[model samples]
Every structure is written in structure tokens, then in C-alpha cells.
Target: MKKTITFLTVLLVSINMYAQENLDLLTYAHTQDINFFNSIKNGTQVKEYITVSKNSVKIGDTLILGTPTSEEMSIRTYSGSYGTKARGGVAQSRSTSKKTYEFIQMGRPAGFGSIMAAMNGDAASMADNSLKNTTVIVNEIKTYHRGSKNKPLYVVMVLGELNGKAFGINKYLSVMDTELAVESGEILLKNRKMTRDEAIAKLKEAKELMGIDMMSKEDFEALKKELAPIITYKNQE
Candidate 1:
């Protein structure tokens, strides 16, 4: 009886530890600061790692960097894809027609390399050319109850800071908010939530939309495929 009790106690303790690990990611994501990675790595030649574990509550997933010793962040993921054209995601306007659509919060990255440096937390350092920073742009966060290969999981991206910085760095995990809505002509014609046809309709309806005339045809199509999953949650609503 004593042995059995000891085993149960150990199991409980293990479960608690696992829960704590998961909570750590959510906490860090909720409150990431400039100095978040000070403890994780230095300018050393070691490997850093980041891993994601599923969770509810828009917590998204966690990214851990470092070898045996890992530094992690609680990050969210969002996807946007073009409709039946099934070409996947296409570039659209930053604004959504629906006021309650998902939310995107961005942090100015000091540099691209800086972001990677921060993510790797000193695990690995890149060349000076690789260091660049830009305003971290967020598009979508896809949450799934269970995994499925057919569905595009999720895709999160950031526009690399242009000639301004050498590289973009991961500073804070942006929390994205999203929702569903009926077709509207007011929102940007090319938002993540709109399908290709819908976007075309909007363009014909409203030429004044900001992002519509910006991207080249090739760039626009690529954008569609890449961002296809940003609005995955639209189906849920």
C-alpha cells in the first residue's frame, strides 16, 4: 500500500510539473518585454531550440530555444487563405470589414537578426547581414481542437523591416484577436478573411482600398497562399 501510494504521488508531481511548463509559455507570451531573453543565451556558439505545445484560450503555442537548456515563449499563430481559387492565401488590406474580426498586435523589432538572436537566445548568432528589424506585422492565429493534415494548420508572418534595419528580431509575442462577419464593402478588399472572388468584388466596388493597388500580381498571389490560414477560425464562428 505504501509503495502504491508513493507511485501515485510521483505521478501527481510529474503532472504538476508538466502543467507548470505549459503555463510558463502562456505567462511569457502575455508579458514579453525587451529584456525577456537576457537569461536564455549570450553571444555563444551553442544551439538553441523552441517548441510549441497545444493549448486552449488563444494561448496558441510555445517556442523554446536552446539545447538541453531551453528558453521559450508563448506565441500565437493565425492563417489567411484565398477562397476556392484555393490558391491559398493572398495579400489583402490590413483592415478587416468586421469590427470584431481577429486582433493583431505588433511590436517594433529592433532588427531581423535581433529578433532571431532573441529567439535563439544566444543559442546561435547570425552574420551581420542577417541582422535586420522591422515593424512586426501579424495577420492571423489558427486554433484547432485536434490535428488534421488536410487543413492548413496555421501560418504567422511578419513583414521584414525594410532598408531601415539589418534583420528583424523576436521581441514580444503579439496576441491576435479575430471574429467572423457577413460580406461588407467597407473593409479593405484584400483582408485575410476575404476570399479571392470577394476581394476582386471589393476592388471593383472600392478602388480606394489601401493595399489593393500596392502588391505586384506575383507578390499578391504568393501572399494569398502563404496567409491562407490566417482566417481559419472564421469557420468556427
Candidate 2:
């Protein structure tokens, strides 16, 4: 009986150790593809989700990606540096750089308003105010195809980060310059989930709401010709 109990205890210890190893592996996996590099400043705890080779980078500064000798990804600044330095010195140092490798969210954005904010650059209210520990997805717009007569509508599903800060909040926590794109006649927006069909319907509805003529046969043909080579990214299942 004592031996049996001892065996059980050893088994439990092994399980715990295995669990710890698994956790370590997960933590290690998180930093495997860090693209952003930040220079350490003021000793802030750098966020794990956003990778920076250096813990802090200065404001209005350009940080090279991959290597110091490599191409410039994006210029960086922080909210902490703003008035004193760049206003959002901490924030700016933490946000993903434009040159950083772009990533798409695994699935649609979690909410409609969030999607809208993402699309319109109003994500500050919706996203965690802290740029350090946030996740934003970005996909390059590949193509825009006007549908056939039967389809009669266009579909545009934006799946990735529109730009830095997910929705317009700059590294300095200041409002960044914004550009608007019309998706299906509605401002291309984010922070919401749209199935392929729903995206199509919304775009169609937007067109109708805007009083734009439905795609004519010729327009549809021309649109398809236009979309022939644009390669958009899709969510990976």
C-alpha cells in the first residue's frame, strides 16, 4: 500500500512538471517571431504581445526591422515622450511598426462597433487604451471585384490591421492621420464579424442606401477585369 501511494505521488509530480513545461513552451512560442524592435527607456515593462528587440525606442525615431542594417519598418514614438518627449512615448514604443510583418486575426473581429472603429480609425474607445498589450490584425487588400449581374453587388471583407494602433490612436496616444476607403459604398470599417454572405449583403445595402446605381452588366464585367490580379489575404482556419 505504501509503495502504491508513493507511485501515485510520483505520477502527480510528473504531471505537474509536464504542465509547467507546456506553459514554458507556450511562453517561448509567443516570442518566436518578434519583428518590432524598441529601445529601452524609463524602465517600463515591455508588452509581450508586441515584440521589440529593444525594450524602448525614442519618439519620432525610425527603428529598423529584422536587423539594424535591414530595411526600415516604421518610424516609432511613444505617448510617454509626447509633451516631455513624444507624448505617447510609452505607447508609441509599444505599437506595431508599419514595417513589422503584418498579421491577420484568426477570426472576424469580436464586435460590430469594434470592427467599425477598426475600419474608421476610432478604436481607442473600443480597444484597450494601452498600445503596449493589444492585438490588432491586418491584411493587405488584395483585390476588389464587382460582382456579376446575378450577384449584383460587391463584397469587401477587411481582415487585417488597417494601420498602426488598430484604429487610429498613434504611438503618442494622439490621433493619427486617417484615410477613408469606401467598401461597398459604406466606409470600409472594422471591429465586427461579417460572414462572406453578410459582407456581400451589407455592401449591397450600402450601395442602395447611397443611391448608387446597381452594378450594370458592363460595370460588373469591367470590375471583374479590374479585380483579376489583386490578391487579398483571408483568415486562416
All-Cα superposition RMSD per candidate: 23.1, 21.9
In model 2, which runs have C-alpha deviations exceeding 4 angstroms?
A: 1-213, 225-232, 235-237
lDDT (CA) for every model shown? 0.29, 0.27
Model 1 misplacement above 4 A: 1-103, 108-152, 164-196, 199-237
Candidate 2 lDDT at 123 equals 31
Q: Per-residue lDDT tens digits of candidate 1, residues 139-189? A: 212221112223221222222232344233434323211111112211111
> Each model's TM-score?
0.18, 0.17
How many times do residue backbones clash in model 1? 50
Residues 1-237, model 2: lDDT tens digits: 687557556644532331221111111123222331111111112111111111221122222111111122345554555355554325535435232111211222323333345446653231121222232232211111122222211111233232443443322111111111111211212322233445455545544644555555566555445443331214211
lDDT of 1 at 28: 21
